[model samples]
Target: MALSRYDGCGETKLDCVSPGGVCFDPRFVGGDGVTFYFHGRKDQDFCLVSDTNLHINAHFIGKRNPNLKRDFTWVQSLGIMFDNHKILVGAQKTSKWNDNVDHVVMSFDNTTISLPPNEGSKWNSLVMPSVTVTRTSNTNGVMVEVANNFKVIATVVPITAEDSRVHNYNITDEDCFAHLEIGFKFYNLTDIVDGVLGQTYRRDYVSKTKVNVPMPVMGGQQRFSTSSIFATDCSASRFGLNTNRRDGVAEYPILHCSSGMKGSGVVCKK
Candidate 1:
């Protein structure tokens, strides 16, 4: 390593290239998997040039033409992982209007936030949910990053008894309430080291948290849309070398409520 002086500061050897760029006044920024603003001339005051060309992070640059399918245009899922040197990005198909990529511009060995959950509290519970993150250090591997606010929709069947003599001989006037909450405590990928489990594995983090999502109320017992949070079995487990067999079970976590009259003991199907 050689020490190079910058702006009069004593020369300091660098172990790694940080986010922006390194020496030679690069008119382009090409770290973290995405290259932006590159000038054709290499030495002619690279950093000072204006109107530089920006390239897409991966091969999906330019207009959508031949290779990628139309579904790729609407990236529904996105994830960023930081490991040894490269940044890994994962994008899925979406039906949203943004036709752009849901997952883009991720770097290896860098700790970036995961994708947001499906549909939940867009402001409080869903946006920017945090998860325990881990990424593969190798080149072009599955990137695993911490994702917060991961949520899934489940069906809740209301077990109600029909009677004509409960309140008004036909129907009641009081509004029934059912408190529902769902959560999952997933182990951090960083805890597994050299096949040994670390103490941090015991700590569980809430990937997603949802509150009374106001299920539609109808006559007697009815079917309602309930929001829940649980650990999902991701298929990318083999890439990052996972340990500690924790079943990514999405079946039962625990359902709780405040009042118990409009509904009874709730049972989840699939």
Candidate 2:
């Protein structure tokens, strides 16, 4: 895979630097092992990965760059749908950077969730034991999981004053542009998976980005756009189309994930 230095993501600890990562300025390390950027418009929602029993959409937020034709967007939140469930993980808007604060937010099936700002703290859904949210750090980091189907490891971060000065982002004192840096892992994706990142996992899929350039990017914005963050209406969406569901409900694998000495508290099987 040919790659130009400028087309790559910025280095950040615990960021999904691996193939499934999404980081600085919305750069992605696709499943094909290629690094690229996708500047979906701020205030819009786009599909990242979609498969038969799973669908993931991202909500973007950013400030328009005066020097560029496009906005410098970041992933503000994730909207996920599987079977009859809807889950959300997002970064709360903030005016200043505070490492001591917890700014991550989450919801399950429309019910808001709260967890202690202590490392290793966790919450389990009594309605569905298979679903869980665990704090990967004392603040601003989390791991959300659904058995063996998928996991989203995320951390809430703010664009520092230095970033604003260097990038000329015109960030204001009232909004520091707090956003999420996330990585994903999928265990049982089908062959028909499709979306910005999902397509790269396909055995026969070919990337359309110019990898050798300074900034490679994936196109076809319209195909991945969704009306709402949780809507499974993207054109390339393969979610909920599986025949394996029973009575319109999907059953997932019973595997589990844990944390310890590897991968920065990422999903590790129990």
The C-alpha TM-scores of every prediction are 0.16, 0.84
lDDT of 1 by residue, 97-208 (tens): 1312232223323445343433221221233234222221111112222342122111111112242233212222331111111111222223221100011122242111
Q: Against the hidden true structure, what lDDT does model 2 obtain?
A: 0.78
Q: Write the per-residue lDDT of candidate 2 for residues 216-253, one digit (tens) a residue.
A: 78888899999999888999989877544222111112
For all the candidates, what are their Cα RMSDs to the real structure?
26.4, 8.2
Relative to the unseen true structure, what is the Cα RMSD of model 1?
A: 26.4
RMSD of 2: 8.2
- Which segments of model 2 are wrong by more than 4 Å? 1-13, 243-270
Provide backbone clash counts, one per model.
11, 0
Q: Which residues of candidate 1, in runs, are more than 4 Å off?
A: 1-79, 90-208, 214-270
In model 2, the clashing pairs are none
The 10-residue segment with the lowest total lDDT in model 1 = 47-56
